[model samples]
Target: MSLKAQLQDEQKAAMRAKDKQRLGTLRMLMAAVKQREVDERIELDDEQVLAIIVKQVKQRKDAAEQFIAAERQDLADVELAEITVLEEFLPKPLSEEEISELISAAISQSGAAGMQDMGKVMGVLKPQVQGRADMGAISAAVRKQLA
Candidate 1:
């Protein structure tokens, strides 16, 4: 099934199961997806849906970090929980070893000799790593390799 259809099915199941937290998160996701469709006037494919989910997950993580920094454990926990919900639809994450290998290949493929070629390295790597690893971590790995 398409990710969007899977989400809608899960949303219905969550409602039937009275899973308030899951229901709320799914609703938020659906709203975001619907908003994007309406704004763009085009239906999103699975990849686009995955991209939206990844964006939501990032937002939750950032919010959780901000909450923690502000000493609001309860809010941080809530954000983290939402992140877990959002991540259910994401592809399994790449291991660090796998990411390192891929980064090395990208560097070699792009002939990125130093930090100056960071953009070239990333351009070669981003599509392969998107939604599977954090871009910040990828960039750091690229820097470490270049340095």
Candidate 2:
């Protein structure tokens, strides 16, 4: 099933099960997806939906970190719980070895010989790694390889 369909199914199930937290998170995600679609005037494919989910997860993580920094453990816990719910829709994370292999392939494919060609390498890598790996970590790995 498409990720969006899967999310809708899960949302229904959550409602039936009276899972308030999961239901709320799923509703929030659906709202975000709907907002983007309305803004762009195009139906988002699975990849686009995954991108939104990834962005949401990242936002929650950042918020959780800030909450922790402010010594607001309760708020941080809520953000962390939302992340857990959101991550259910994401693809399994790539392993370190898999990520290394992908980076090597991308660098070679792009002929990225130095830092100047970092964009080329990332351009090759982004589609393959999106939602499966952290882009920041992938960029750092690419830099280390090129350096």
Best by TM-score: 2
Q: How far is candidate 1 from the true structure (C-alpha RMSD, Å)?
A: 1.5
Whole-model Cα lDDT of every candidate shown, in order: 0.95, 0.96
- TM-scores for every predicted model: 0.90, 0.98
- Model 1: colliding residue pairs: none
For candidate 2, the TM-score is 0.98
- Model 2: residues >4 Å from true position, as ranges? none
The true-versus-predicted C-alpha distance at residue 115 of model 2, in Å, is 1.0
Off by over 4 Å in 1: none
Model 1 gets an lDDT of 0.95
